[model samples]
Target: MKNQSNMPLYQLFVHPKDLRELKKDIWDDDPVPAVMKVNQKRLDIDIAYRGSHIRDFKKKSYHISFYQPKTFRGAREIHLNAEYKDPSMMRNKLSLDFFSELGTLSPKAEFVFLKVNGKNEGVYLELESVDEFYLAKRKLADGAVFYAVDDDANFSLMSDLERETKTSLEHGYEKKTGTEEDDFYLQDMIFKINTVPKAQFKSEVTKHMDIDKYLRWLAGIVFTSNYDGFVHNYALYRNSETGLFEVIPWDYDATWGRDIHGERMAADYVRIQGFNTLTARILDEPDFRRSYKHLLEETLQSLFTIEYMKPKIMAMYEQIRPFVLMDPYKKNDIERFDREPDVICEYIIKRADYLKSELDLLS
Candidate 1:
């Protein structure tokens, strides 16, 4: 959870034209080249502003990749998430830590101070890119099919079924395999999830996925109250060995009872079930619903407590307290910076209890 020594303080200097061009065309296909200096080593790197919501008129998040196939700490690229919405910049890292604790693969996160053209750009969360290196780090095969599920992959098979062409099924997913040729692996998965009879649905679905783990992942998302993540902001990876796709969470700056603007949402924000198509279908089965309820109880008992998370939350707060206060680019009220950590602490306590009550009612 602490900063790693291998990823140096990223001192980046980009040409004014390139920077302006990227800002002008925020969704460009090509990455603007920049002279990046990390640990006093200069390299030709391609940089691009990424993210739909975080693309501000002033500051934006970045996707950085090495031009020469070089890697820093075994990562060819890293996502610099400008957590502009989170007053407490530690939310994303803490969310990722919570996911890892819940027994799911999450991107490794670290805090970093970023400087562009000798100007400070506040603190940024440098996250591991979900690329080939990420899978290798997870000890999985190199050729595993990976898809970045965007807002289009809402898990609602109805959305895909209405489309006249198979190309529409690829709406929310961006394939990392670099092959545009449509094999319909994802489409068929969705079709079976939607069309399979209730009698044999679980058996057929489990053949292509770790349903228990997927259920846990869904429950984990709801427990954290990450409404933004139910549809998108995740990595869908087809496990090489099992040949089933597993859910890996991404983009949690809006989770943990916080809205996109970092304000608190209602305590009982998300429904206990039916957030997505696949999730709704799975929960309809009496057995799977029981498993979800059991998992929710187990999580609330095991790790979803103030006692277990307070130390980690406070440690992150202490680490970022100074940098965040000094950040001129940070838009949140300076007074609210340190105060939100305790709010998150409180959210953990309340969410665990609330989920317990809801599960009881559902049962």
Candidate 2:
């Protein structure tokens, strides 16, 4: 809140109308000429489609969108989406910074400054125009695909459990009668992080690089305290050139010590890495599990080694901590967690430590 208004220019995007008004309002003063242009024609009809590039418009313009557009003219404009105007928007923008710093960035993307309404807001990002890069038109051959599962098809596993728990209490239903069903749902909800070593599914890089790099990415998410790894948040696509599938992560809410499940806050990395018979078997042989375990350990060690996470974690806490207040009704639900910021912090630290210890053993 201190310097929220002093946001940088690159972080901001101006609607064509807004751009024209700003030019007129501050005519005598300096205004950054519109580097990026919006396709007002496209944005007018569909709320989902933010804008496409109009040939008449300038190059290097950007747009914000909540959903993917159906089409773009000539791969048109670069889009920096703040689809959800929530507490995590700034973090998503900063994530571009994080990826850039780590030197693992894929697309050309980063946060920039912007002034919107009377107040200055943070979390604006800039991306390279999609047209700049080659958009692969040739689809890859279909095969067995490994995906991070989203919600349960019938009902979200979490919702089903809650409903069942409530129903059992009202009636005289025995716990054991539904225990098996409950466990099945729990097992079903866990994500599949890595693929098995089959003749067809094996990657050439798997033989070269130690699995540490992939695990480190997962560890970064945990170190950030993010647990929202639903399917849409990530996709591993086959790079047309190399023919290798790489992990792409998305969705960063419910992170940095925020818990959606009230009392149910588990470390993100552990939730994914924790092995059951089902997960272990799905991953094929013991070697795959062992590799994953070692990767998990190395990831933990790397995250905690230099305290690379300290400043960013604390900064995020400072930024969003004030707004994490519970609603009046929900306050009673989390009374014990009130003022217990240390619990969240400690959970994150300990999880990191546990992974480090696991890695140490592997070494």
Candidate 3:
């Protein structure tokens, strides 16, 4: 196969001993020493395999952090997703870009070819790490950020695993940057979501969250049909200036007409209303419900159309096709990869229609 890809290349050089130790336990959270060579510059980094089930894959995702105060592209850390299950390998980037276009806070992403020890590791999605740097880069207010690690981050009083009342309200969140007081703030918000009276829920909840931003994020998940996204697969950033929690999307490779396993998903798999305690409470109020409905309708008519999305989808597909053809890991899915653009465009049409039909429920 001819090598015709123009994507940026990242080279990782790890000591043989460290490489062995890193591979010995893919499930470990510890980072091994490595040197990353990019654009003819070498920097010391700590590398670790990231993600839950993805660690079990032959080609694994990686999390890279600088040794100290060093930064890469204005980011202290970065996540390189293998996107092994996504035949298209562009869904994560596309979904995140969509969120940004919708005026929602989302991590930026791009395609990059990865090589380890001079051996080709194939195409990877390089995602901006949502941390203090993320806020600084965007010139956003200083805030506390937390990752929804699992389903327990569902903004509920109950545990997702045992379905019992959770001992701690912060069961599923891992604080990325925040003080102890931030934890209390999140707990208080969750408590209000589940316990606030119906008449006062809207007013009280709005005080803790940016309802418009949350609604836009919810619409992105619903349109993309990421079923697991409702409960987790997101980050929460509490803006210090406004004192309101806002959502940032993460790990969206399981979207764009496919389930986490990369199987075909129906357009209506996720409802227009979305899920979770916080979402439900927001939609319960008549004014908020109307705002969400209007937002969804506008999105359907504008951004979610084939006319609007096909060009973007095809651009991504074409850019990666040359690389995909040469990718060793994607050989089995070459045909499927070629078909993904059309598949995703068709999904956009079907999903838009489904949501249009279900819009009455919101009314």
Candidate 4:
């Protein structure tokens, strides 16, 4: 039976910790326990009516919201999160650091090594709580800042209007060319350009005239050889009423090209076809082209000079290589990826040249 009362029981299996001791210390002596002890068994943890049910939460990453029971102490409502089972505790930390460097705001997470249950070699991550933000969907417009995947379109859930727009596009129809500005793409480029007015940029924070900073970032992404950076894997969130927006980038599993070297992994033209589509659809406008071109040049020169991001990229590569590298058992599964190195290298070279062209214009 589906429970529609906004509360549901969730089963959580935790590698046992000092939760038992902690619970006793907080609740046993309290006049009224904040959290009721529901069930605890060896390496098994369960909670009943503990907090609000989290929907759309999945392994690896999730956002949780919780309200305090009337019996609990101090705060009225609180939220917390956990990331568990990482062997090196690399992904969570790297993710947090990457987002921070990119100026994306998110809840802080700390690495926690769990070895309390008489079991060794366990690791977990604890994260600070964040409040839920309502989502509003809008249709992609002409010169609209949008991302299309290499293959699929049904990535983010579409509202009725967006669905209708996509259906209309799939037919012979198209959004009138150059009617609207690709605002988000423009924003991204503006940050990449030199002498661009700070007020013109739409970030909530100060707009730094720092193209070198962005160039290093681009180099990092290229060195990592992430192929899915095109539109479908990235997007923006806007609060319609406030008009404030934030970019949301997702999907990284396609990166690293474990079966192939980074050069070949980055050259795959099939993987990079989205670049042409993006140029045609989003960068087709004269204003966008001019604006982004200026930023592109600045970004290129900066990346060409910086030697640090290369090592950072290499360090990151070494870090995740073991987890993603092709193994003897997985040879049959990964053979195809190994066959095509130029496919990846070609894409990276093209991307580098594109950036260089844009930068050359400035000189």
Best by lDDT: 3
Deviating ranges (above 4 Å) for candidate 1: 1-8, 143-145, 160-167, 178-183
Clashing pairs in 3: none
Compared with the true structure, what per-residue lDDT tens digits does model 1 show for residues 25-48?
A: 777747898977777778778998
Q: Write the per-residue lDDT of candidate 4 for residues 239-331, one digit (tens) a residue.
A: 233333334343332343321122233233322112423233223334444545554454445432234234543454343333223222222
lDDT of 3 by residue, 11-110 (tens): 9999999999999999899999999988888889999999999999888899999875499779999999999999899999999999999989999999
Evaluated against the true structure, the overall lDDT of model 3 is: 0.91
Cα lDDT for residue 178, candidate 4: 22
Question: Where is the poorest 10-residue window by lDDT in model 1?
Answer: 1-10
Candidate lDDT scores, in order, read: 0.76, 0.37, 0.91, 0.32
TM for candidate 2 is 0.46
Please state every model's RMSD to the true fold in angstroms: 3.0, 14.4, 1.6, 14.7
Measured with C-alpha atoms, the lDDT of residue 147 in candidate 1 is: 54
